[model samples]
Target: MKTFARTMLAIVGGYVGTSAIIAALAGIAVAAGGMERSEAATLTSMLGFVIYLAVIIWSFADPALLRVALGLGAVSGLSYAVVLLLARAPV
Candidate 1:
């Protein structure tokens, strides 16, 4: 049961967390680097592959399932919040 849960979290949670992080990073790049939205998104999307792979590996490497869950949830939630704020900010 635990292994099943971990595998699911590694696949689903990692993807969700990675996506949120990529969005947040793109927002940051657009805001801070003054980059065009499309360029920022393209760069972040490419980087997201590596980030997602690392997330999946870490999810499995971490022995504590609860910690893995918490980390993923926290990061995903925080990144989503950043995305929301960025969307609301004036250009």
Candidate 2:
């Protein structure tokens, strides 16, 4: 059961967290780095794969399952909040 929970979190939660991180990064690149939207999206999308892989590896490497859950949840939630704020900012 613990293994199953970890696997699910590593796969599903990692994906979700990575997606939010990518979106937030892309938005930051566009707004702060002064990059074009398409360029930022492309760059961040590529990095997303690596980030997802790392997230999965970390999920498994971490000894504490509760810590993994909380960490991933915090990352996903905070990243999504950043994405929302960026979306609302004036162009």
Candidate 3:
């Protein structure tokens, strides 16, 4: 039961972490005006699969469950927060 719960949490973490990271990166690129919006969108869309794979692998590779949960959760929160902030800010 405990292992199952941990696995579930890992899956969720990987999903959230990868999505948040990608969103944040794309948002920042667009908001910062470093690249064209269309280009940023394209790059992020393509990169998402790689990021997702990495997150999934990392989730299972880590031996410590606490680290995986907390680390991924923190990363997700930070990335999403930046995304939200950028959303409110004028581009």
Candidate 4:
């Protein structure tokens, strides 16, 4: 039961965390207008998948359940803040 709980938590945390990170990055890139919109979309799609895989591997490999949760939560929260700030910035 404990193992199952940890696994589920890790999966959820990784998914949410990875998504938030990707969104934050993509938003920043878009706001900066560094790349063409289509290129950004393509890059985001490919990079998002890679990030998800990495998060999954890391989540399960790390034995510290609390660390996994807290780390992800922190990253997600920080990412959210960054995205929000970027959104409000003058374009």
Model 1 per-residue lDDT tens digits across residues 21-58: 99999999999889999999999999999999998999
Per-residue lDDT for 64 in model 1?
93
| Per-residue accuracy of model 2 over 9-44 as CA lDDT, tens digit each | 999999999999999999889889999999999999
Quote each prediction's TM-score.
0.96, 0.96, 0.87, 0.81
- Candidate 3 or 4, higher lDDT? 3
lDDT measured at residue 55 in model 2 versus the true structure, 0 to 100: 93
- Clashes per prediction? 0, 0, 0, 0
Worst ten-residue run, lDDT, model 4?
Answer: 33-42
lDDT (Cα, 0-100) at 76 in candidate 1 = 92
In model 2, how large is the Cα lDDT of residue 48?
Answer: 97
Per TM-score, what order, best first?
2, 1, 3, 4
- Candidate 4 stretches greater than 4 Å from native: none
* Candidate 2 positional error at 71, Å: 1.0
Comparing candidate 3 with candidate 4, which one achieves the higher TM-score? 3
lDDT of 4 at 75: 87
Tens digits of per-residue lDDT for model 4 on 1-91? 8688677766776777777787787777787767666776678767878887877777778888778778778989998898789778887
